[model samples]
Target: MTTPPPNQNDIQNGAGSSPPRQQTVALVDDDRNILTAVSIGLQAEGFATRVYADGETALKALLENPPDLAIFDIKMPRMDGLQLLQSLRAQSALPVIILTSKDEEPDEALGLALGADDYITKPFSQRLLVARIRAILRRSELVRNPPEDAPGDEQAGTIGRGRLRLDPARHQVTWNDRSVSLTVTEFLILEALAMRPGVVKSRNQLMDAAYNDDVFVDDRTIDSHIKRLRRKFRSVDPEFAAIETLYGAGYSFADG
Candidate 1:
């Protein structure tokens, strides 16, 4: 008696247990091969994927119906990833990761500065890409559903220092009662600094607080984020000097 192959329903339902809810990921790239490969991989990992070949289409679909997360190729035709990100940031705080090539470091930096949560260079390992996606999703989930019994301002999902107020749940920041927008990564970095005012935080420390442990971001990434953070705050208040940079050391938040 030969054993029979599993049916499609059996496989989908794991023979007995029910399938878990699928998280949706939007993959926007000009490369069909990349889109297919990534979509297949993410599907295998129990995620639902929506693929678009250009930034314009992706941007339209994303705004019409947002996904749990988004990954974009920086070299897309039409609007391009950076432009799409700029447009999206103006309306939504959606988590976005940009894909770049080795030679597109400047574009990658610009994407991050523009509000992308993370970036991966082209020819990246699928495992690493998935890890980054998972890490970002985890952070997003945490922000959405904070622990009810946790202590501290972070637990309360709101922190304030001086005139700066951060609401993790709402993903909102306000300085001197003026609303200021920040990327997810930027918010985490600012929250860490504001949590311990006057305490210097090394680049590594900031990265740990802002990004997943598995993500190995460069020092320049932190610098770019900090630079953008300062710019955003300073735009509202030119005298905003709460973020003090310590050369050869790190950064500190002014207590007063």
Candidate 2:
């Protein structure tokens, strides 16, 4: 596989001109094929990428110089992604996305509990990965610099129900005044439910609210996100019961 030649404007800009710096994504995986393929795919889509062949090496560079986002693969030879994530979470809140083996919930739950923003099952589509990257990045942007006029945004503005409060403009959530850190996907799903408290939202509806129409996400993905949302809130409020399930009828939020 050959790399495409550099863009003419990129060469000119690097030579003597100034341009906006590309958003860099760091990818850590032991598989050289995955590292090479994903890095190329991301670059072709207009991103700067850094790839590492193992978790131990990636962890060091990540601490010294973080990227806008990171994608980690579990089960690395040297340091394993989970340990690296635990260490990084202790020092930084840099947004991270994870890759997990197919149908694996324990690792997914553990990663999300440790503050990962999103996860994609293995054998996933590059299109889906790119879509997830774009979604999380957009949400990150909203958190950093919110616009008052982006009200049309599904995750925009503030929505409150009982002890739960969501300030999408700031990417902030609180349960009974205690702050809760949530992934963009989690926040969006929660936002949808809280927007119409007492009303049930099917997984499909929630997905539509959180993801672009072009991207296809299975129902299990939404279910996992819901599980993480509950787990995060419960960490702060042991009696957190605002989010409810109806079994075969989707989920809802209790305003009272």
Candidate 3:
């Protein structure tokens, strides 16, 4: 019996190798100059980009059909990047990178807290941005198109720790039979933790999981996201505050 070819989803995920040249990237910013500049840059890099002048429009487009990746400026008219990220977190696991004009740590911290996968403060190098985008795409590709497991491992679908269940195939997460909405960054962080269960994952590890490359990312960026993730768990199931933080060490997802 000849093995059948990989499924369509696998092809779409870049699993079978003819990586498409035209990938959709949604760029959101109120400034026409910034929007035009980013769209042009991405287009030059062989990506098809959609420019939105406001977060509201971007969110609507995302809900209609998710993009390969999304980059949003933090400050915008009407809905801001944070709000758009929050909404997108509920609907898709698309990679997100946030752009901001503020260099303040607090602003950076807040953007991370709001579910941005990576934060780029204004006056950033375009080359660096493109590099980061490529890195994020590579990482997401792994999750979107998982490796074929050895015969025994093929049966596994749900990765669980107590009541938390991560359904990698469906990209759905649940706690006590109820679904949990996590941003792409949050899901990747959780997946990394759950893969090891009792093992503690240092902040750097989590950072690498989200960004997929060794670049200088603020340590506080991790802390802010963790705080936000913990709050989300607390809201869903109070006992879920169990995701432990080992003062100055790192974090571990284990049975509470």
Candidate 4:
């Protein structure tokens, strides 16, 4: 059970984990039910929860203190989730999963385009939410601390394809020597494509590379991520076209 503080705004809920390194998840939603239910749900999975009544409060605290991950509801007063996401993307690459009450593709597409790692519709299952948080956290951790034998040096474990460089250990990518921030999902997807330059990777294959077996994402999700990836690369280099789409097939990478 996650017990909110006296005021509860921008504050951590539940008992503190001074022993193990517990990841904290910030929930920004106008709905009290969602805040309370999701808080307890995340606590049950050994994660600390921070509940915000709206996106405005969450954005301020998130930028100052930050969290392991954040879930933002699309509709909110003071500031909406998409606005918060867009504002946050201007400063941080914090892993974010947006919650949308509407079952519209446009919302999902816009969120993804604005640097959200994932999006979930309202009335989502607690198990699925917890699963997504864990999956993204795991990837984030791997990027921070790669295995000893995983090519950690300057020249090792880094895949260089012409002007693009993929560093699996750091979960980083660069185009034309300029840095490009990508979400955990985007980084993994790009890594998959860069690892095998000419070989096309289907949406299913990409979903496998980035996500765990328990969590599932569809083809459109992959497509959205790909679009964002291109947008990000193009931000650094306008002529960026390494990511190729083969109609009726899949996507491949070719830096040249």
Candidate 5:
């Protein structure tokens, strides 16, 4: 398959550009054939690649330092993909894509919820996958260091919950003057959910915003994290349980 021309903006941005050095990709899958094929395909596209058979090994690698992008399989022998995603989100918002051989709804929904930037069903074409990788990479580069003069300077770094305050820069969350300690992922997820208040975001969308697609994650992973977030909020203010779960849909931060 013919490769699309390199993105000009991505090259100019230089946020994570490796070009001649070859971009690196972490591929985690239990299937040796799939892993080898993906690694070979990515290598053909000038990406340096690392392959892992399970989540535990992948997580260990990430702990030292994560790759620019990770393509993770949902079902693995150990430390399932969803758990790995949660672990990653608990600390860092790495760009991640969920790949699954099964096309089940639960898998899709859960992966999105866990903070996967994107999900690709199995039997996918190499070309489409490559394009998605490029697009995600370009977006990540842009987000890492947005242009100083970019429009909407006033809108940058503002986090709120109907009048509730969440100062990201200060790492503070308050409602009527009481502070809260939320995990970094929880904070970001809250920020995204609260931004539109009442507007429902699918599991996939929520995952994308919090993790920003920088890490490979699973959707069900999102459900587990949200459960943790709800528990924390319930501990502080019982009435502050406004994170509504829309069955068959996703979730919406209730309007205050």
Candidate 6:
């Protein structure tokens, strides 16, 4: 006789073979059509999704049951994307990607300044969205589980330049012995700079180092990240001046 398929519990317990648990993504948007379409696309790609119609609701649910990643729409009612981003940043460093409409460059810049990891304008391709999500998640995973045989696989796994200390394995940064919190993107950007002190890296070079090639990031995005990076370091040490800009060129990390 033919055997029946394994039940959910049996599959989960490995009594029968099954794919690993799918990562969950929280999709926040007031547009029902967009929400449904994106949710379907994400689910098709082996991702479980939680959908919300407004920012306030999404924020509550997200904090209560955090997901692997989140996507927010800039024009949501009750609580817009920027406000939700602000609330989320206050408590967690959950990787976030914001959605904006065409001609909303200012909004995009503001979102990035407020700690958004990335932003995509409206009318974006679904495939493009998926690619962006995967890129961010990939970075997050790397930060969580660094390579066992990383170039510097020491007990501390830390890199230092002057007063700045970076621990790639721990995904931590310290300045003058004090801890400083940085978003995954910010950490990557700073790491690239600190890796080669006094070496000016062009915007394209920094972008290549920080993000996957599939995701298209403009020069302003890099500039915004640099600005936030400096702001964060300055907050910890008022006289922080390690990052320097070269007009008509790019940026370099001072060895001081």
**Best prediction by TM-score:** 4
Off by over 4 Å in 1: 1-21, 142-157, 167-172, 176-179, 213-220, 234-239
**Candidate 5 off by > 4 Å:** 1-22, 142-256
Over 39-151, each residue of candidate 6 has an lDDT whose tens digit, in order, gives 76776677777778888878877888888889999998899999999899877778999999889888877887787888888898889988888888877865545667666
Candidate 4 achieves a global lDDT of 0.80
List residue ranges in candidate 2 displaced over 4 A. 1-21, 31-46, 59-65, 73-75, 79-132, 144-156, 214-218
Please identify which of the two predictions, 3 or 6, would achieve the higher TM-score against the true structure: 6
| Per-model lDDT | 0.80, 0.77, 0.72, 0.80, 0.69, 0.80
- The full ranking of all candidates by TM-score, starting with the best, is 4, 6, 1, 3, 2, 5
Residues 46-132 of candidate 1: C-alpha lDDT, one tens digit per residue: 777788878877887888888889998988779899999999987777899999989987887688767788889879988998989
Error of 6 at 119 (Å): 2.9
Clash number for model 4? Answer: 0
Q: Report each candidate's C-alpha RMSD, comma-separated, in the order given.
A: 6.3, 6.0, 8.9, 3.6, 8.1, 6.2
Backbone clashes in model 2, listed as residue pairs: none
**Candidate 3 ranges with C-alpha deviation above 4 Å:** 1-21, 90-92, 102-104, 142-179, 202-205, 212-220, 230-242
lDDT of 3 by residue, 15-64 (tens): 34434455777778877777656666665676766777788878888777
Model 1 CA lDDT for position 41:
73
Candidate 5 lands at a TM-score of: 0.58
- For candidate 2, give the lDDT of residue 4: 34
lDDT of 5: 0.69
As for lDDT, the candidate ahead, 1 or 2, is 1
Residue lDDT tens for model 5, 1-256: 4333222112122235556545667877777777767766777777777777889888878656666778888888878887888787666556778886655657766776666667788888999888878766764543334465643313656466664676654445776466665644566677788889889988888777766443446666778768877866666787776889998789888868
